[model samples]
Target: MRTEEIVAKALEKIGNDRYLLSNLVFSRVKQLCAGAKPLVDMDLKHNKLSDIAMKEIAEGKISIDRIDEKNL
Candidate 1:
């Protein structure tokens, strides 16, 4: 629905899933491959995320629930 919502969802699950891997439709958006592994790693290490999924989330290409934070 909104970037805030997407980020909210990511953060909601951050505690339980520091890796931020859950849900289906957009699992690929969260999944990490060789080229994308750094992205996920950096997202977690930097405590942020790329906007590649921004449009998807905004456009409802992906669905999110909530977010949380972890100590890491």
Candidate 2:
């Protein structure tokens, strides 16, 4: 996803909850580092893990359902 699209979806899905959003991005990046395939169709060559994770979130490909926000 493009930067603008990612920002839009982040606002829609996470609102102003930066902590929760950060956690989601962190988890997704970890997953990517562990060999998980990206959920969004992005050009992997120029994209970083954080970018790909953001794209996945923007496209509704991942969620924070498994995260225990209260623990953070």
**lDDT of each residue in 1-72, candidate 1, tens digit only:** 466776566545434353443343245344422134332212534433355443333344334442112111
Span of ten consecutive residues with least summed lDDT in model 1: 63-72
Candidate 2, superposed: residue stretches over 4 Å from native: 66-72
Q: Give model 1 RMSD, 1 decimal.
A: 10.4
Question: What is the lDDT, from 0 to 100, of the residue 42 in candidate 2?
Answer: 70
| Pairs clashing within candidate 2 | none
Candidate 1 regions with alpha-carbon error over 4 angstroms: 16-34, 37-49, 53-72
TM-score of each: 0.28, 0.77
How much does candidate 1 score in TM-score? 0.28
> RMSD to native for every prediction?
10.4, 3.5
Report the C-alpha displacement of residue 55, candidate 2, in angstroms.
0.8
